[model samples]
Target: METSHPGTGDLATRATEILRELTGRSDAAFRDGQFEAIEALVKDRKRVLVVQRTGWGKSAVYFVAARLIREGFGGGAGPTLIISPLLALMRDQVAAAERAGVHAATINSANATEWDEVLGALRDGNLDVLLISPERLTNPRFSEQVLHPLLTGGVGMIVVDEAHCISDWGHDFRPDYRRIGALLASLSGDLPVLATTATANSRVVDDVAAQLGSDTTVIRGPLSRDSLRLGVAPTSSPGHRIGWLVQHLGDFSGSGIIYCLTVSAAEDTTRALKDAGWDVAAYTGRTDAEDRARLEQALKDNALKALVATSALGMGFDKPDLGFVVHLGAPSSAVAYYQQVGRAGRATDSADVLLLPGTEDAEIWEYFATASMPEEADARAVLAALADSPAPLSVPALEPLVGIKRTKLTLLLKTLQVDGAVDRAGTGFVATGAGWAYDAARYAAVAEAREREAAAMLEYEAGHVCRMRFLAEALDDPTAHDCGRCDVCAGQWWDSSVDAAAESGARKILSGIGVPVEPRGQWPGGMEKVGVALKGKIPAGERVEEGRVIARFTDLGAGQTLRGFLAESAEDAPVPKNIADWCITVLSEWDWVERPTVVVGMPSATRPVTTADLASGLARVGRMVDAGNLQLTRDPGSPEVNSAFRVKNLDGAFRATAETAAAVDGQVVLLVDTEIGSRWAMTVAGRALRLAGARAVLPFALALRG
Candidate 1:
């Protein structure tokens, strides 16, 4: 791929030609100065990073530049390596390009044989562009065995899409992105790299530049989209806001997405909407890849009218006809909200981005903030489990040791590997088996890092400054145009009395003397209208005596007191912290928060519990009783060991005796206890009990007997 006077004529001519072909507009037609700079850079062969928004012709910029490199230089001499973030995205790009007459192929970890073929094609100068992910490139084998050789021969350009991933400050940061700078240097004989992203503020630009080892040519277009109408709704529960969604959906013509924080919430909403006779589907991280494929196809084909999903559902998914995007859960930052809502209004016609504010959004983010990391003991347990297993253990298998969410667990494992605590082999991770030694100092370092990140997140969430300004500052862009599209921008929607009532309720519960509750968004009567007012404030006339409880404020005894229907009826205990966290969120959003509390955990209370608890709890109960009969008399401290006891074969007499003794008078109700699975089982049981009888039946014990 050799050319003469590379800085002048040939590169410019070819870039113009490609641009004309793609947009049916000549390079001269572009009034934006980007093309001139791009033309100059292609001739000088400098690394470039272009920052723009979605629907802006950013991809067209690279597509044209790549062709210039190909045509100006000799044929079959060098190839362009485009490091994309995802396989689906890579495939989509390749297919889209192929449709437009560009020869491109994907090389990812999942397709080694195809990767080998692609590498061979590149070596033979048959490939014009090769798309791969950063993860694949980081594999030493891919770098040493493939990239090093290709670049040494002669490679023209290296392009990184979604360049924001390189920034640690980005909302979606990938650890592998840290190596992209070094990767680009390796791929093109240290050739000039051009990075492109749909979203990047000044902070991301610096990070992308530093990551690419070049000063980025940041071409930031306006973030504003006049065609998109941004609206914020103050609702108590996401469920209640469905009416808003229904109203909008009825008014709108194109497809829509309702983003929930949890998989179950997505499913529940999908079901509820379906019951109401809406053509909708649900998507989450757990949705099988095949299902996602079908869903995407359905979306493209207009077979599905709407989709209820978590954040995982729509990445790299392109749907130009999308008209509405609903936030079933509150997002932690404005940037995230922007990205999700930006999915709609892809074309020219106006689109609707609806935010249904619920109390749980803050709490969900806090859960991630306070999520426990694997301690030294936990690491040891995890290592032991992995060491004992002949095969690699799935994350679920190690749940007993690392009690955390799957996403956090994955990141933790990655951190451990990077820190040399474990070695990854193929898809499964193998314990290094270096030694049984646990280093307190090393553990402290990791803990400190976790705490620092958590603190940063907390600050970002609770900041009183402009959301757009905060995002801009984080992105390293010191200057940012004020985006008047946020909760703070909209004035208080609640009434003064409601705000005062909310504050009084919160002060009644959480305040000591004069300290007021801090609210999330602007609320009337100061902090009174803020959802945090729901935390400590009790509603007037709300009282509890025995089983019949009076409800004034919904926040009191949130996770502790069980509400009973009648005096003789058994009361189900209060919603758990996780569930209450979701419910209070609902109340706060609706101005029903007599007392609002800052979100400390979980995203929303509307998220339903799972079924796996029934299996585990039933098993534990059966084992304990079986062991008690077998004389395995062990202390209660021993979780694995059970104690055996002997009793007279009396039933009614046994009950009378048990009732007469003060110590034994406690009812042996099958409470799920404060377990993750317990909440789910209780949720299921509570629902089942409502449909069945008033008799207190031991749900799990019966299953164990069965």
Candidate 2:
């Protein structure tokens, strides 16, 4: 191959032409640092790091650079390999590529059927850009069959989007992004690389840059967005937050997003808004791909007022004129808050951005913050189990043995895999037999860093300082200054008081009962490995009828009272009069096909008085047979264990005595518990009761947790 690089002026002219094509605007020109990033990759053949605020045309830099490289302006004739983190991002980039007249395709989990066609396009030299997800980098099949040839043979340029995710200090816990560093290191030589992010602080940027390359060119800009008017709406409760939205969402100009910390919150918010005659949909990680596409299109088309969503809606969906962003609860960190709210006011002059902080935010923050980092003891336990196993063990099989929940275990395994302590063989994990020492100091430092971040977030919500400047300085923006548009910099702009009618409606919605308790249809796999003989589907004769919950532990209604009674610090006592009334109401209003003729309490190792009182009260009030406590024949052990382990722990813990069996013989049984965490106890206890001759069993609880 011969070098025939285009002149700087020619490169800029061609890049501008592609930019106009991509933006669909004849006058579209490069924003500050955009063309420089493009030229650094195509002309200087240097690795570039772009740290700009949202909507600064970061995508244009890579797309233009890809076009230039493909046109042979930089002595390259290979397609660009963009390692994007999210599927929504890939969809957006591909669409933008087509508009720029670049033949772009993607290979990701969502497009498995189109992979062969996409690979054919790559092989035939007909593709200009090929986007892949970070997940693919760890796939053994994809690594050997696809990535190996691409990285070794040729690539015009490698683009790492949302590059902050690669940093150990800054992730919503994207363990897969660690694999990108390995991919960057394995490149043959001298390949142009680019990394881009909108919400990285200086520390995160440095961390990502160090992993990217020692010579990486960091082009950072001011983080403040002129179009965003940030504010904090202080509300005492979740109901007040919902009421605020129900009353004031129409005050905004156009469609936008309402961000929630969890899927349940998102769904609840969506239902509240819709019930108040607002056109909104709940979008979460649980949303199906097809529905997400549809809901995204609706919001883009401005057919709906808003999408109540979790973080799954961030990082990828682009709507140029999104009107507003409201947080139903405070985000765990400032970076995440900025990234999500940045989606608004991109192509518009101004957009409203508000945060409604909840008292529970700190608890939620602690949960998500510690979810990714592995503890030394847990790591040792997992490694020992894998090493001692005769064969590779799946997560389900390992869950009971290690005593870590599935979600935490999955994340730990990924971190371990990236640390060279484990490898995937088929559907299970195996020890890599490598010398892997747990870095306790590193984990501790990370925790301290998070604590500082959390403190900063609480400060942001307090609103004593300028909101925009606080966010900008948090990102280490050197040019951070007070924006005259924020609630602090300027005077308050929103109506902070909640409407009486809307507040009442919100209270009604919150107090509404009946969260269904889904019965465990199948016993967890590999239960026999833990000495529990359960396997396959639970027999219909042993399974409990679909159960009911008065409220979730995290709910804001009767749940507040329920959470108080059952809190770890609360003394063991019978349910309060108000909470008991709520429970009895739930039972009386239950829509079951058959009413229970007998009541039995699931024996509680801790809260025996509370559990027994509830069962006896319900039986006495409803005039049903009282069967007393299901005898605790064996200890149930710690409730922190995962499904298979928990089931094994509860296998013989409860015994349905002959007298208890006769009490409910051929009669429906209402099984009561103070709270349900794993639900394995409920399942096993109900099975015993059924085996002892109850015709049907229905489990009821004061609260449910996911």
Evaluated with lDDT, which candidate comes out highest? Answer: 2
Give candidate 1 misplaced runs (Cα > 4 Å): 1-10, 23-37, 74-77, 109-120, 138-153, 185-190, 243-248, 369-405, 418-421, 431-706
**Per-candidate total of colliding backbone pairs:** 28, 0
Put down candidate 1 lDDT per residue, 1-706, tens digits, no spaces: 3333444556556656556666555544443646854664465566677765566666666566666666654232356778888655665677665543467887764344255567677777777788878776546577777777767767767778887777655655665775676656554433657787766656567767776665445566555454555555554554455544543455556777889876645655665566456788877764433355567778768787787888776446677778777777666555556667667777847676656666676667655543433456566667777888788766645554455444566766654654456666655677876765555674465445435544543454453654455545544444544546544454433221223333343333222111111111111121222222322222221211111011211122431232221111223333334443332333323322122111001111221121223223332433321101001122212111100100011101111112212211222222222222212223222222222221221212111100
Q: In terms of TM-score, which candidate is strongest? A: 2
Give the per-residue Cα lDDT of candidate 1 at 691: 24
lDDT of 2 by residue, 556-586 (tens): 6566667667765568898778877887888
**Alpha-carbon deviation at 113 in model 1, angstroms:** 7.5
**Model 2: residues with Cα > 4 Å off, grouped in runs:** 1-9, 171-173, 516-706
Which 10-residue window of candidate 2 scores lowest in summed lDDT?
1-10
